[model samples]
Target: MQSIQIETEYVTLGQFLKMIDVIGSGGLAKWYLEEYQVYVNGEIEQRRGRKLKPGDQIEIPDVGKFEIIE
Candidate 1:
């Protein structure tokens, strides 16, 4: 699994995607969510505003696995 560090208390799923280089801009979060399957802690997630904090795990099939860290 890959680790992503954040300085804030939390990061929105949209911001996380950008941090991981999955999307070019925050505006594409909606489209990306619709086009791809994003799993948050084993459950499917599609909200761009979903808050992701430290210890959270994200899995994107065919893409990669990620973990949020402080």
Candidate 2:
């Protein structure tokens, strides 16, 4: 599990990806999302713009898992 530091109420999957620099840009996120390489709460998430709140867990399969934190 991993934690992401944030000073906001919540973060979207797209924003989180950007904050973590996982992908180069929004375009890349979209491509990856279309490929279904992203997962949320143990399920494949094809929506790059999925909203994520504290306590939400995101799993990127071979990549890794990101646990939202306060």
Candidate 3:
């Protein structure tokens, strides 16, 4: 598992994905989100606008695991 430090109260899933290079761009993130299975705190999340806060864990199967940090 890896940690992603956020300087705000929350970060949108798309923004986080782009910041961490999961997707090349916002548009790609939006498109690819539907194609891939993303989990937050062990629940499948398909919304690109899903709000992720500190301590939230995101897992992308076969890709990697990441945790949000303040």
Top-lDDT structure, candidate number: 1
When 1 and 2 are scored with lDDT, the better candidate is 1
Query: Model 2: runs farther than 4 Å from truth?
Result: none
Candidate 2 lDDT over 1-70, as tens digits, reads: 8887677788878888877778787777887777757778878877777888888898886777888888
Error of 2 at 32 (Å): 1.1
TM-score of each: 0.97, 0.84, 0.93
State the lDDT of candidate 1 residue by residue for 1-70, as single tens digits: 9999999999999999998899999999999999999999999999999999999999999889999999
Q: Which digits, one per residue and each the tens of the lDDT, describe model 3 over residues 1-70? A: 9999999999999998999888998888778788999999999898889999999999999889999999
As a TM-score, model 2 comes out at 0.84
- lDDT, candidate 3, equals 0.92
Model 1 off-target regions past 4 Å?
A: none
Models ranked on lDDT: 1, 3, 2
What's the lDDT for candidate 1? Answer: 0.97
